[model samples]
Target: MSNVISAKNLTLAYDNGRKEIIKNASFNIKKGDFVFITGPSGSGKSTLLKSLYGQLKPKEGNLVVGGRDLANIGSRQLQELRTHMGIIFQDYKLINEWTVAKNVVLPLMIAGYSLDVQETQAHRLLKHVKLSEHADKYPLELSGGEQQRVGVARALAKNPVVILADEPTGNLDDYSSNVIWDLMENACQQLETTVLVVTHKIPTIFSLPYRHFIIESKGVYEVH
Candidate 1:
């Protein structure tokens, strides 16, 4: 398969390069691959994930996602690139004012789908995420796990080519975490969506062949 994400000699830093996180790290993730990036707190796992989604530019070297080189991408280009990607955050990032279905409809709305089409997709995706009963509920009314499930549904609503999840199950119970993992795994296997997740631990019950990478001491290494 073709590479969906590629990093060559990548160096990432923050605060005007005063805080260097990753240094000279290189890796490639192929299309339709399920990848887990693990590291302890302060290890730069999130930093690497941020770079993949264009939230952080490389301090040095080349980083590419969906064939777009992030090193010199413009704001307009970055916005365009994000439309094709699904991103799930640790905090769920749902708009409290919007109901669950509406939140899932946001991406389709942004993509200019008709209201009818948007609602249809929202309903379909919410069902897939097993949140159909809670579609009309506000985000604040749900539990942490339910809120994150909404986030996952929203991310998949656009049928994105790749999904980037940063510590997606960091605050969930085992059952909830497994549900989230199953949804992502299904996307990878059924829809051929590439998934790259940053987390402190990889669930031992994950029952699929996947690539594993770990961040340590300012470098990234793949585990066999």
Candidate 2:
């Protein structure tokens, strides 16, 4: 498999002036691979996800994604690279005041796409996520799971090559979680995109066809 993201002796920590979250972690995510990052709370799952999306720069070693060394990329280059990556968090980061269609089209707007094209693309993705009927509705009108489904649709709007999801199914019921997982799996297969999802949900251990990586003892390793 081709590697889409690679980390070598990568380290991350908060400025609390105390303990580091991820310590000398090294791993590679191959293109089109669906990998799960699992561990106990505070084991650095979220921190690691953040680093992959360029939110938190590693305090220590080299980190590369899509053939670009993240540690050395300029802000403009980072922005361009990030355009090819999608990130989803536990919370559905939707604009409450905007319609669902508007929320899903925001990324395209930021990327300077035309208004008509953005609307068409947003509607198509909303249909893909099974939320087409709710396009004119507000975030407050949707359930938590529905909001997340919209998030997933928006994440795919730019045809990203890699997707990093942190606790994506944390608050959903079994059916909703399964739906989200299936959608992600399909997206990866159809687009040849690499997916790294972080979650503590036990059911995930047997839920999907993913290579599991456990974060423990300040290191990351593929589990048997």
Candidate 3:
């Protein structure tokens, strides 16, 4: 199987003079695979996700995603690299002033797609996430779960090769959580998108069949 992400002996630290959160961590995500990243509150789960998405550079070791060497890539290249990736944050980062369709179209606009084309894509994705009725509503008017559904729609709008999610179900109830997971699972199976989720929902994760990676005070481990 081909690999979508590969990090070798990766070490990550903050620029704020804090201690290294992850040390000598290495892993690979094969194409079309779904993987779970879990750890204690401060065990570097979010740090690892940021590094993988190029928000933070590795202090030591090589990091590669989709055949691009992250360490050697320039800012322009990093932006381009992100075109093949979709990221979901714990807080639904939807623009409060923008309508649901407009929020979902943000990525497409950044990619310089035509407005009409973005509209079509946005509508399709909103329907996919079952938010078609709220297409004209502003994010602030939606519930937390409804807003998160919009986030998922936005994430998948670009048809990215990889999806990175950080605490995607953090504030959701059981029904909403299951809905979000189903959308993510659909993305993985139907779009051949590799999924890397940083979440603390171990009980839910334990029931799913996915490769697991755990980060602790000691180091990173690939758990079967």
Q: Which residues of candidate 2, in runs, are more than 4 Å off?
A: 16-18, 202-208
Per-residue lDDT tens digits of candidate 1, residues 102-191?
999888888899999988898899999999999999999999999999999999998899999999999999999999999999999999
Q: Against the correct fold, how does model 3 do in TM-score?
A: 0.95
For candidate 3, which ten residues in a row score worst on lDDT?
Answer: 201-210
- Model 2 scores a C-alpha lDDT of 0.86
Candidates' C-alpha lDDT: 0.94, 0.86, 0.88
Count of backbone clashes, every candidate in sequence: 0, 0, 0
* Model 2 residue 19 distance off true place after TM-score fit, in angstroms: 2.8
Better structure of 1 and 3 per lDDT? 1
The true-versus-predicted C-alpha distance at residue 221 of model 2, in Å, is 1.0
Scored by TM-score, the top model is 1
TM-score of decoy 2: 0.94
Q: What's the C-alpha lDDT at position 183 in model 1?
A: 96
Ranking by TM-score: 1, 3, 2
Clash pairs (backbone) in predicted model 2: none
Name every residue pair that clashes in candidate 3: none
